[model samples]
Target: MSDSSGMPMTFTTGQMTSLYSLAWTPSTTGGYAGTCIFLIVLAALSRLLLAYRHLIEQKWHDRAMNRRYIMVSGQNETDRERRIIGGGGEKAEEAVLTSKGLDERVKVVRSARSNVQGIPWRLSTDLPRAGLFTLNAGLAYLLMLAVMTLNVGYFLSVLAGLFVGELAVGRYAGIDDNHH
Candidate 1:
């Protein structure tokens, strides 16, 4: 068979064809194999980006929780001090950390469900997340286009890439199973 350019189409071996664009045309079997490998790596890279975005989100959450803990813990300590000094009958052991105090801290930390810096959501904190989302989407669409070539080799390569990528990074990607 022949394409618009009159070059003999290599449908069987999936060679001698253009993929995605003119620049991606592979003229030989070896070139086509190389292209397949490139597609696999590119697909895997998209998963890596997803894992990176997850890491950033986790870090932000931890930071915000730590900040809230500090704020709440300090306030609790001050209140305890006042109660002890004002009453003067309570033992020094009352100043020790208790389960109730910890419960209060946890509650305070969980209540603030806003951005990393506490309440004010800024574009600066969101830019990296947005950029990664765009990049990951672009890579996914690029791989889809490659598969649209309907070449058996390219299709399998994309599938293998996704499997390998998930094995490597999907666990840390923080995708909830219930969402699926």
Candidate 2:
């Protein structure tokens, strides 16, 4: 039955069929878009945290440096005045800074990050270097696969890579199997 004419009916379509979707609809796009957005936001938050940490560290360093400047300048001015006033015994009042035996072992460790420039090459130079290359390459390939795959596959691959890499490292460095 028709509305009023009662014989036959023709339907009219609306213009806003696609526009019915929310302009900022995220939920409709399924998992990929939502997951990617979440990962992006996570990465951004982590980066911002790192930057804030760096800023705080730099602020502390700056404060320490400023204090050092005051102490150093004051000591210099004192020595200068002492020399101008005392004739010969100024050496008795010589300023000595407390360095506290900074052994630079920390520098050696931190330099690992900076001095990683020729790292692959350095690994090549080690004895039984093929093992190092294999270990490094295996770690890298697994890391790449991890970034691309589903969770279970990534976890399995990482485990396998770790075993292989550890075996290679131990063999190359002459460590017994029990060492690890």
Candidate 3:
């Protein structure tokens, strides 16, 4: 069978246990050089967009905390406080008596936990903004599928994309910064 573009359509159900396949077809050209380069660039951008979505979500979560939004389930203030201070090495007491009021700190921590847990649900339910989360997830799944193609070059391309994406968002996401 051929697609509307007159390109022969192909599908396979065989087990994919490797990372090498010639399944991807570029829209522009069928030549290996053109298609491979296109797929590589597309994969890289998709991964970058995924990373950018994560950065956006992180910022949103922080904003939600600032708004004092809490979504914890079956956890009370004491539980939250314990979770926060229990990991205190030696300055647990000092950690408790910071500039911010105890209640305020507890609220922030609770909100953060809530944001973490509710992210999936919120992404599906919250309109417009949910698009980012959905896109991130879709890109992740697509990247996985691309890996299943088992093509060494495709696998390398996906890996390169992920690495580049991380580098692009690392500073903005504060991934390497100590958050204590």
Candidate 4:
């Protein structure tokens, strides 16, 4: 096909079916080889940028607090009540009280749980934050799929991108820390 400038466009399907080669067109001249290399490098850099953005999003979510409340009932009520009252005084007592008073005390818990056991309990409150991570996860998966195409150029590009991205943001994102 001819483009607006009347230069012919050539399309070729590579031998590898699994490899969904990127739709990059090299300039129709002796410099085509250089143009192809440039495009590959650009794609690699773009992948790195995407990874960096994902890391940034994760860091932001970690720092931002999305306030929510969880109701504690059943056998744990009395224990929770005592803990709240012990630390919070009259305000905590008043906060836990329902219209029926102490007989129906419902402990209001903060959304952010410190450990794994609290995940199920905090699902409702944590959904919004989870949604943010979901987007980052989706991008990561897409990058993985691209890598799976098994095109040597693209595969190397993705690997290099990941290595560079990790080096750039690993410490800032706390990925290098043992505690996390």
Per lDDT, the best of the predicted structures is 1
lDDT of 2 by residue, 1-180 (tens): 235833223322221112112352233444434434433443333333333434444454443333211122323444532111222223323433235642221111111232324233333234434554455455444344333333332334344544544443323332222221
lDDT of each: 0.66, 0.34, 0.50, 0.46
Clashing pairs in 3: 18-150, 19-150, 19-151, 20-150, 20-151, 21-151
lDDT tens digits by residue: candidate 1, 13-109: 4476578888889988889999999989988887787788888878866654444222234455556322111221233223324456423331222
- Please give the ranking of all candidate structures by TM-score, highest first, separated by commas: 1, 3, 4, 2
lDDT by residue for model 4 (10-45), tens: 432232323223353333433444433443454445
Query: Residue 46, candidate 3: how far off, in angstroms?
Result: 3.3
Q: Give model 1's TM-score versus the native structure.
A: 0.64
Query: Which portions of model 1 show Cα errors greater than 4 Å?
Result: 1-13, 69-111, 114-119, 177-180
Candidate 3 per-residue lDDT over residues 1-180, each given as its tens digit? 546954334433223222224354433323544544555666666656655655666777765554433223356756543332223334332334345643323222333456456454454335646786577567667777766555555566677765665566554544542211
Identify the candidate with maximal TM-score: 1
Ranking by lDDT: 1, 3, 4, 2
TM-score of each: 0.64, 0.25, 0.44, 0.39
Q: After aligning candidate 3 to the native by TM-score, how far in Å is the CA of 121 from where it should be?
A: 8.9
Off by over 4 Å in 2: 1-29, 68-146, 150-180
**Candidate 2, lDDT over the whole model:** 0.34
Once fitted onto the true fold, the runs of candidate 3 whose alpha carbons sit more than 4 angstroms away are: 1-30, 68-125, 173-180
